[model samples]
Target chain A: MKNLKIDETKYTPEMTFDPETLVIAIKGKSYPENTEEFYKPAFEWLEKNLSDLGKKGLTVNLELIYFNSSSSKALMNFFDMLEESVDNGDNITVNWMYEEDNESILEYGEEFLEDIETLPFNLVPLKSRE
Target chain B: MTDCIFELKNDLNKNGIFFCFSGPISQDLIVEIGDTLKNKMRLEDASKSSMRLVFSIIIEQAQNIIYYSEEKVRPWSAGVNAGSISVGIITVAKKDNSYIITSGNMIKTEHVDKLKEKIEKIKGMGKDELKQYYKSQRKKDPDEDSKGAGLGLIDIARKVSKPLEYNFSSIDETVSFFTVTTVVAEGL
Candidate 1:
């Protein structure tokens, strides 16, 4: 297993996933012209990394400043993958973090938590900053 | 008669719309309006949570127009963009026990149907299920860049009392326009 890191940019977020910790983190804005183009590789990496997940545990930290509708579809696919991984005996925990004053983002975290009941999910609060 | 128009004004004692601006938007514009609206909300005693919803809707809708409006024109500033963006919200507290903050803007026609479908699906979802769906989408296509992924409307619909309503008006041979509105109750 290996680790992958996609550094942040003005329009993109910081993504860091470690196979050893089974932790995946995506934080920042997402309005990429080709979302699938960017995420396809990440998904593929996860697929290969989790092939023998019978004894592995995974945790993902999701935080965002903002994302376009296009990015939203990609996010759904990411969650579905996590659900599949959990089903495949990979203990999965998703920690959705949102700013304290950003009620919409908080509710967003809550909404995602509702979709997947098969895995462990946490809706955590982060301080709002300008 | 001229009296009819005058009478219309007399009968409709207005609040003098505090602020209204329309057409292609930008992040700077959003931030500026956010400041103004936040001040207004504070003055009106609107709950922090409610204000956040309204603010988020503005960002979502404005960004939608900036990035997806089909009637796009070459931006005024090179490299920067200006789509069919508009930002206008009016809040009227009626005697009928309803506080309405109605806002709408033009959108691309091609992006409408799937948006409607996604809103409907969200309206039918229970709270817990809505969260799960949101998460699933997050995990599945974390880089959701499709013009139609439409998580923005889904998130907004989850706040409204009913499904989202939209309209597409034929603007010309090449493009159609769109508008979306969301209504939140006073004490929901």
Candidate 2:
């Protein structure tokens, strides 16, 4: 399947999915007016490609500076999909990256970490991006 | 009318409000407002976390207006297919070392009771409780009438330094004005 690439917008995050490497990177702020619409394509891509992923493993890196509540819900849905894939015996891991000083973002990551049942979710804090 | 402009400015200043906007609200406008507020807070040397809290509150409140506000206007040039923008007012102020964000918009009278009940329940929740509620709500599908995730108010409740404050006033038989305020303590 073709790779998925969405450029960042003022209110949306940059998202890139590499089918060959089975790595997906999402970075930047995400507060799109239509949260569902903004994430629909990625969700579709994952649905279409999940079977092909097999035992190859998938890595998702999420580095969000800020996201509004709706976007938060979208992220939860994204993780839910990943968890379902993991449940189906697909090898999947997620890395939630946040700035060390950003307590709120770190807290959010922690909450998601606590919620996941089986997926390997990591809260990786980077040094302050000064 | 021109003379009243000066009085209006003074009134806002006296109330500690540094930023205020009223009328049609769109997604693009929310981005501009968020950026301007972020820059202003950064200049004041506000901590990153405090800024994030304030910014998040503003986005939640502003987007609520965009989604649920009863008042709306569609630009004639945009044609019929273009969507209408909601009308509302949003303000940011400083008081007692806290940043205050207040937003008001018109809402259908039928929604007043349900909305009031929702806010009252959220206000009664402690931080931990709010966090749990937010997570639970995030897992559910948004209500049919909801334009965004139904978790916006709960998210605002969790980040706020204090309980959410809200009021409803009847505008007529069919609609009422609803206003909600959130506070973020500086130097968090």
Best by DockQ: 2
lDDT of 2 at B152: 91
Which CAPRI quality tier does the interface of model 2 achieve? high
List the global CA lDDT of all models.
0.63, 0.91
- How far off is residue A112 in model 1, in Å? 3.1
Q: Residue B62 deviation, candidate 2, in Å?
A: 0.7
Tens digits of per-residue lDDT for model 1 on B101-135? 44454455565676566666777788668766755
Model 2: residues with Cα > 4 Å off, grouped in runs:
none
lDDT of 2 by residue, B87-154 (tens): 99999999998999999999999999999999999988888888889999999999898999998999
Model 1 misplaced stretches (Cα beyond 4 Å): A1-3, A6-13, A19-22, A27-56, A63-72, A97-110, A123-130, B1-16, B26-45, B76-146, B161-176, B185-188
For this target, which candidate reaches the highest lDDT against the unseen true structure? 2
